[model samples]
Target: MKSLWLSQAGLDTLDNTVALCPNCHRKMHSLNLEEDIIKLRDKVKNYNYK
Candidate 1:
C-alpha cells in the first residue's frame, strides 16, 4: 500500500503537519481549486440528475 504526507506552511511536524489521502504516496505540493460555488449553484438549478 502507498502512503501520503502533507507539509503544512510551517517548520515542524507536531504542530504543522497535515495528513492527506494515504493512497497518494507523495506530498501535495500545490492546489488549484477554483471557487466555483456560484457557478455550481446556477448549474445545479438547470441540471437534471437522472
Candidate 2:
C-alpha cells in the first residue's frame, strides 16, 4: 500500500494487504524499490480498470 499508490485506489484494503514479518518489512523498505512499486501500481491499476 505505502510502497505504491494502492491506497489511493482502495487497493490497500485488508483483503489486499499482505502480512509481512518485521524483518522482511524492514528489508523491503530498505531496498528503496521505487521501480517495483511503480510497476505494481500500474499493473493493478490496469487490472482494476478492466
Candidate 3:
C-alpha cells in the first residue's frame, strides 16, 4: 500500500494515512495537490447506494 498524504516532518499516525493502489498512488503523487486528494477522500466518505 502507498500513502495518499506525506509530510516532511513525517506523519506517524494512522489518521493521516490512506492505503492506495499502485496506479492510484502514482496518480495521486503525480497530481501532487492536497485539495484533489482531499476531494477523493470526501467522495469515498460520502459514497451512496441507490
Candidate 4:
C-alpha cells in the first residue's frame, strides 16, 4: 500500500487512502515521484462523493 503519512495530501481519511500492488508501491517510494503522488491523491478523491 502507498502510505499517506508522508504524502502531500490528507492523512487518516477515507479520501486519502488506496490499495496498491506491491511492485507499484515499491516503485513509488523508490522513485519518490511527484507525479505518482499526485495521481494517488487524485485516485483517493474518487471516493469523496461515493
Best by TM-score: 4
Candidate 3 on 3-49: residue-level lDDT in tens?
43455455678766667789888887787777877788787668673
Q: Where does candidate 4 stray beyond 4 Å?
A: 1-17, 48-50
**What is the lDDT ranking, best to worst?**
4, 3, 2, 1
**Cα TM-score of candidate 1:** 0.25
Badly placed stretches (over 4 Å) of model 2 are 1-12, 15-30, 48-50
**Residue-wise C-alpha lDDT for candidate 2, range 1-50, written one tens digit per residue:** 34433434646565466455887556556774878556655666676523
Distance from true location, Cα of 27 in model 3, Å? 0.4
Q: Write the per-residue lDDT of candidate 4 for residues 1-50, one digit (tens) a residue.
A: 55555366547785455688999878887897999978877776675663
How close is every model to the real structure, measured as TM-score?
A: 0.25, 0.38, 0.53, 0.57
Instruction: Kindly indicate the candidate among 2 and 4 with the higher lDDT.
Output: 4
Tell me the spans in candidate 3 whose CA falls farther than 4 Å from its real position: 1-4, 33-35, 44-50
- Output the better candidate (1/4) by lDDT: 4
For each candidate in the order shown, give its overall lDDT on alpha carbons: 0.39, 0.57, 0.70, 0.72
Candidate 2 accuracy as lDDT? 0.57
Error of 1 at 4 (Å): 30
Ranking 1 against 2 by lDDT, winner: 2
Clashes of 3: 0
Better of 2 and 3 by lDDT: 3
Higher-TM-score candidate among 2 and 4? 4
